[model samples]
Target: MPEQGKKNTLIVIVGPTAIGKTALAVALAQHFSTEIISADSRQFFREMEIGTAKPSAEELAAAPHHFINSHSVHTLFSTGDFENEVLKLTEELFKVHSNLIMVGGSGLYIDAVCNGLDILPDTDLNIREQLNQQLAEEGIGAIQAQLQAADPEYYAKVDQSNPQRLIRGLEFFLSTGNKFSGYMTNSKKERPFHIVKIGLNTDRTILYERINHRVDLMMQAGLLDEVKGLESYRHLNALKTVGYAELFDYLDGNIQLPDAIALIKQNTRRFAKRQLTWFRRDGQIHWYEPDQLTAVITDLESSLL
Candidate 1:
């Protein structure tokens, strides 16, 4: 335990997909004799295990984990909801553990927990529905063009292929007549616990190879059948992710299975690139090769001490 006057520490493990964040987090949690909070937004839904690459049952048993497969895909859990729940969980966990581990590749979710999110005004539902319709009819390019015209700053930084993000940006512009990026205060919120961010990375070629292998493994683990089971809920926002979306296209007869699998690998690589781009902007993160477990532990101990 930390000294009575010392604040609890949140050791955050951030990295791209298939980068071994789960194994690292579990190792760190065991080292600290503490628990873990998963900040990976995709893993929150219970139905998404195979595609989301959720920790194995053995891994979950190795260290107590929170937020992994905790919610149903039918539920609409937003980043704001995550922020509130994680803040409460962290406060409660800190009373027992001096150091806690948080691991995920979701940059926005991690940002919400580290620095409070700016509460934008409620967008008009009509505008959101219209944008969604436009996305379905005219495709992502139409929304991308609109966002580029309205909020070039956010457009440049956002994943242009994601309809939800583009819609949100365009909705904010239409509703408030201001760029979505303008609403982001970017101010770090004071937390009761101290935060130490650790980022894992590797050569791009190696990372892409890992992603490809992971996708192949997911297929072997029945990701296609898992996606087929959720066909009824394909329109849900929760299903609008790289793996699921690509598979859905296959099920829709829009692409061949092989092509869909290839697209999954390509899109996942792109998503990893975007995640790195987002994390790179945060200068506080200490970067290390994914396999440098001992060094990460040593650095973390130095911070705690």
Candidate 2:
């Protein structure tokens, strides 16, 4: 337990996808007798279960969790919205527990809670509507090319597979003649509690293998059926993600099922690399292997005290 009057500690778990983040988070939350707030934007939508690799019923029942299946895919939940909601939720959770766990591979969402998000200028709704129209009419390639030309830096960092992120980058540039990357000063924001960041990673070969195996498991677990059920909603930004996007391609006859599965593994590997790139840039995070839970708890307890 944390000492009296010690600022509440938010132990943030971060790393590449399929890096055992959920398992580590559950263990830590249980040990600390605290609740978990998921920062993985992918896991927020209730419609996305098998593909998101959400914690199992047993794991969830082991610890009280917040933000898993907390939103609908049909609704638009921006990063700014997630930032505000998580901050308020964290404040409330802190009131009950001195230590809490916030876990995810989504660097932006976690950063939003630890360091405030950049102040974005208001954009014209018409501009957003036009961009959405362009996306629907011209396909993701159009938005990808535009964003790459306008802001290559954000283009390389943002998920190329996600149309929503791509459109946001292009929209920001069109709205203001400034690049989206320019607004990211990374200026630290003060929070009421102390943050302890823990990152999990391993050899790239092993990580890729893990990602491939995970994709195979998702297929065996009926990821195709899940994507099929959401077919009517493919146009939604929520469906523009790695697993769903590739499967949607198969369902649309753009590719065979085998090819779609292959693409899922390939795209997932790329996503994990991007996640590592984002987290590596932050120097505050303590590095650990998935097996180093004991050391993390021991060192973390000392730091909290």
The candidate maximizing lDDT is 2
**What digit string (tens of lDDT, one per residue) describes model 2 on residues 1-305?**
55677799899999999999999999999999999999998899999999999999999999999999999999889888998998898888888899999999888888888998988887767888999999889989999999999999888778888888888888889998889988874587899998999999999999999999999999999999999999998889999999999998888889999999999999999999999988998999999998998999999989987
Residue-pair clashes, model 1: 0
Error of 2 at 33 (Å): 0.7
Please give each candidate's TM-score.
0.96, 0.97
- What is the Cα-based TM-score of model 1? 0.96
Q: For candidate 1, lDDT tens digit of each residue in 85-131?
A: 99999888888898999999988889899998997888898999999
Global CA lDDT computed for model 1: 0.89
Residue 248 miss distance in model 2 (angstroms): 1.1
